[model samples]
Target: MWVFSWMSWRNSLKPPDSLVRKLNRLRRQERPPKREQGAKMGKRPRYHLQGTAFTGIWLLALGFLLFLSPPPDTGRCAPPPTPTAELVVRAKFPAGKPQPPPVTSTAAILVDAQSGDILFSHNATTRLPIASTTKIMTALVALEKLDLNKQVTVSARAVSTIGSKSGLEQGESLTVEQLLYALLVVSGNDAAIALAEAAAGSVEAFVAEMNKRAESLGLTDTHFANPSGVNNTKHFSSARDLAVLARTALQNPTFASIVSTRDFALPPLADGTKREFHNHNVLLGELAWVNGVKTGSTPYAKYCVVVSGSTEGVSLIAVVLGAAEDETRWKEARALLEYGLSLRPRTLLCDRGQLITQLDIGDPLGRQVNVVTDRALVARLSADQVATGTIFWEREARFPIRAGEVLGRLEFTCAGRSLGSARLLAAQSVETPNIDLLLEFWRRGWAPAFLTGRK
Candidate 1:
């Protein structure tokens, strides 16, 4: 059986003679002529039809790209493009000559209510008696130290106060809110003393607190002799200092409301008679923009006024000290406020998210990182200086780079002086890479800019 199986396998392994001849003939058949294939696979000369098709497609794409219109020319009824990154620009202030203010006050200052930027100044820091505006500080202390609804019994000391009386008598009871109205609206000395006693348990102790508050505020030329703002040689403040004080006071909502009130009727008297009083701040309710604030006058202090007003989302604080007459205080205050509000703020020089500049980080990673400002650059310059300021920057940037790290400062200058400075911080972190890792990153398709040394 083994022999028979071997014989069958050998016969099957041998091919038929006719089939072998056919295979050999097919193998010897000639192939068609071919083009030389240089050193690569699949290389061939282009045919006319193939070339025409490729050229047509390319021309179509090129024509489509060229169809776009060019950008509009500047100053031709079109807005400028929004800038993503920009070089620091230079501008001058007071675009034109500014006329002097019609001011008759001995000392005065105009300031932005929120930023404390002095807009206009004349004898700003020369200390002189502040008169009844002193009550502003007293009201601030009371508001901070006492509860609004807390009842205060008018004392003999409060009733004895002579200047600008609120008509409170001994043993009379009133809430702190009512006393504040009397203090701010009527400019009453008695109301001030009552609030002082209510807040600190005594008038003397409250005066001590007032001095301490002045010290903490860094008022170099301010001293408070009394809470009522009576004419005292020691009780003096500058126009700048008073503006600072009024701006701080106006931040309190209760104080703001009280000063702005045209008139208020008090809680009924003991005999059921209603007590009504009007604001002494003549500007309040008289002008379109004028609001809560204070006015004062004495023989020695002349006339002093601290007025705060807002229009079109901008608030201004104006102070006039030692004006020649009562009318002079109001006229000078209005003039100062007009000047402040007339000076429009410039458009944003640099937006909060806009890239201010680039910081170059030499080698390994071998590229630069972007530095952005943390806040918007808004110029608070006088009317003439509005859009005319120069920008400067710190030229050096350090590593190891970090996101949100403060890198440098952007200073805005005009007339050879700094107007303001904005901080420049890193927007993205870029770490230095080791040589081996850097080479590996490049090999594995790192950014082309990094590899080509195009900062």
Candidate 2:
């Protein structure tokens, strides 16, 4: 059997065309051996077949076929993957997420910094005294109402602030920018008072302004008592409200810069002594990703912090109010942020079907469709932005929209930023738009301007 197989293999081998051509060329220009030159001079050369050379050529061709021929079952695009079907109606997910990885804060919430999507919430609306975290609003109000380079005289009232002083002297002067650095970086109660007084002419007015701003922001569960978050019954905010405040406040480029700074030095007073400020948000150096908003604590408020973090393009904000300890707030913030962002691109916001509010047809036969996306879409959105989006359907899709015809487009946006869009395809073909033989070419092709007017 082995001998038969070897014979079959040898017989199957054909002489390589390239080697045959080379031998034919050699025969036309035959060069004899030195001794045979004299004997065969001027005569046609004999054609000699070399068995060893033929074997080598045949083996080379066999090798090429064995190595170069690809397997018969190769594919065009590697079997086209598992066909990632877009999450349609079934993909709709709720933004009101449950507990996140054992958070330690009493009332905490996580949200997308831009979209305001509430990823997780626990007692988020429960109004509780937020300590120095109140400065976040203070910074916002000042950034909006006060000039950053304007000088503010530190008053005796500011010098007397109780908790977390920025060491301001009664007669000292500083720019609004300098005071903001102290206010946010050190959680300076004194700086907060100075900023409030400077922005509104008095602390009372500033607190009122803060409350008004809260109301304008649609924060139903928030109020402000003082610029510095002293434990006043009136000075309280919910975790959800704080998250909203953080998002709003961070939108100001000046306020965002002040909060995110890890360290800053105050402008020298008359004595030329520079006061160094360090951010109370320890999560900065401790964790690579954590960025600032504020950290607050008092005997009444325990510990509170508003933190934002990001890895890649996905970012998150965590508001933890009333933690047992400062470290607990930081840990809880980190957990909430990580948990929210880990489910990053997996979040499917909405699709064309949910966005189609209504449809109008202009044909004689009124037609409608269960609008769906022609190309299925997977959108990333925060919980808050999901409730609000723009759906633009044509005012009138004149006659004959076939099945799968795009009627309109739905764009998912958050905070004025577009996430993505999907085509609103007609679910079924309308009967009136069906092949109407009565319609003229002029109507179908559109009227020529010269025929209609003096073009």
Pairs that clash in candidate 1 = 91-388, 91-389, 92-388, 93-384, 93-385, 94-384, 94-385, 95-384, 259-292
lDDT of each: 0.73, 0.71
Alpha-carbon runs more than 4 Å astray in model 1: 1-95, 345-455
lDDT, candidate 1, 32-125, per-residue tens: 2464867445533344334444345434433332232111111111222232323444334455655548777899999988678888899999
Q: Give the alpha carbon lDDT tens digit for every residue of 1-455 in model 2.
A: 65566456446655447646865675555555566544744544444334334445445545544343222222111121222223322224456653468875789988978667787899999989998888988889999998889999999999998988887899788999989898999888999999999999999999999999999999899888889988888778899899988888878888877787898887666688778877888888677767678988988999898998765335688989989987788788888877886555345555445535335553323334566765544544433334233456643454445777776666655445565677767787754321122122223344345322435
Q: Candidate 2 — what's its lDDT? A: 0.71
Worst 10 residues of 2 by lDDT: 74-83
- Regions of candidate 2 where Cα sits further than 4 Å from its true position: 1-99, 268-273, 345-455
